[model samples]
Target: MDNRDAVSAFLRSRRERITPEQAGLPVYGQRRVPGLRRGEVAALAGVSVEYYTRLERGNLKGVSDSVLDALAQALRLDDTERMYLYDLARAAGPAPRARARQREVRPAVRPSVARIVEGMPELPAFVMNNRLDTLAANSLGRSLYSQMYADSTCGANVARFAFLEPAARRFYADWERMARFAVGALRIEAGKNPYDRELSNLIGELSTRSDDFRVMWGSHDVHVFRESTKRLNHPLVGVLELDQETLSLPDETGLSVVVYSAPPGTAAEDSLKLLASWSATTGQDQHTESASEPSDRHL
Candidate 1:
């Protein structure tokens, strides 16, 4: 997508989500649009209506930081969204060559990183790139995401499984909420790595195949996947409520380690133990099956 189109879409989406009352502006007349009018936004941002209209039309090439910040405030944008605006502006500038070089370098998890994941047998740990591709996972991690692994063609993308796979509805307790969060997180990644070919291809594929994905993508939402509480409905062990922590691998650029854990002496902890046991058994079965089928097929 062109930088102008992305910037315009993002600005319009943000503008369409804020009402006059929400922005502390008086409702003067019958509104044609759902949210703040262009004139109202321009007034709030201390800019002319024509200038704001130009910005909303995707002319962000020479936009100043003060102007962007004022626009962000006027739109009531969150931190992620504000940063995304900056990213869009930067992408519209003369940085395409640097971005292209970065995209050409594919990120990989180091052997030491894989060993770290393996060492965390008690916790469900996995390494993922910015695209949410599971580069490495422990046995428990693999078992926790069994549904995603069930479809070999889908690979190890969390976003793909959440949006494109029907089994996700059964796996995630709050499937719709998780789907939206996944898409938002993907959007944030896209903002950071605008030239990533794999990320773009994955997004294009999901947008084409999944209506839910397309809708979420159109929202222009962005989120940081730092830490959260996730509830999962495991097919073998029933429900599990786990605390998820995402740690960035400093040496690996776009790579991160995601670990799921439960507090001690809680029912969630017991469920995790049961899941570990089940994972062990499933691992053995998969090993036996590997002789006949492809060894790379996850359990």
Candidate 2:
């Protein structure tokens, strides 16, 4: 992906989303385009129209922090959006420096992290990378997301399961909202790590396969994961309203542990208990079947 195109699209998208009145600027008779005009944004940001146009054209290279801040304020960007703009600017530095940044090593799930996931027997917990690939999961986590695992085509990727698998539409009660959040989060990652080949490939796959993904991705929205409630329709346990928490690893490995839990004394909590029992039973059955199977020697 071209950094310039991304930078240009992001800035233009943000600018076009805001109206002149919203920016506290006086509106003239009839507007030729949506949102505030380039001159209006330039005036608001305390920059000349020509300079603002240059920046908007995707030449964020050598842009100062203060100028970025001014543009952020003029565009009424949220915290996440402002950070994205800064990331884009940082990426637009000297070619050699940007190339150095491009060579990233994929992080592995450390033994301690695996242990932490396994330690949570009662809760559904898993570790995922920036691309939402399920690196590891506890027994209950695997059971909770069995449908995603069943579809090998998804490659244990959350976004792929959501966009490519039809079952995901039913599994996630609020599919549209969840899908948008996923797209937005991926957009933020792209801005920060523009040259991530795996991430770019995943985005390309989703865009090609899912029309819904295309619309959401085109929105250029950004999101940072936080504690939220997710309603999942588990095939085994039925509907479960679980609280989701995402904890990022301190080592900056781009890996996050996601845990799901339900409040005590609620139906959702009861369902979780039933789901755990089912997982255990399923494991036992698989073990027994495997043990009883005839060996190749016998054949």
Q: Which candidate comes out best when scored by lDDT?
A: 2
All candidates: TM-score:
0.90, 0.91
- Per-residue CA lDDT of model 1 for 111-193, tens digit only, reads 78877888888898888777777777777887888788775532377888888778789899999888888898888777766
Each prediction's whole-model lDDT (CA)? 0.80, 0.81
Expressed as tens digits, the lDDT of each residue in 155-186 for candidate 2 is 27778888888889999998988888789889
The list of candidate 2 runs beyond 4 A from truth reads 95-104, 153-155, 284-299
Off by over 4 Å in 1: 153-155, 282-299
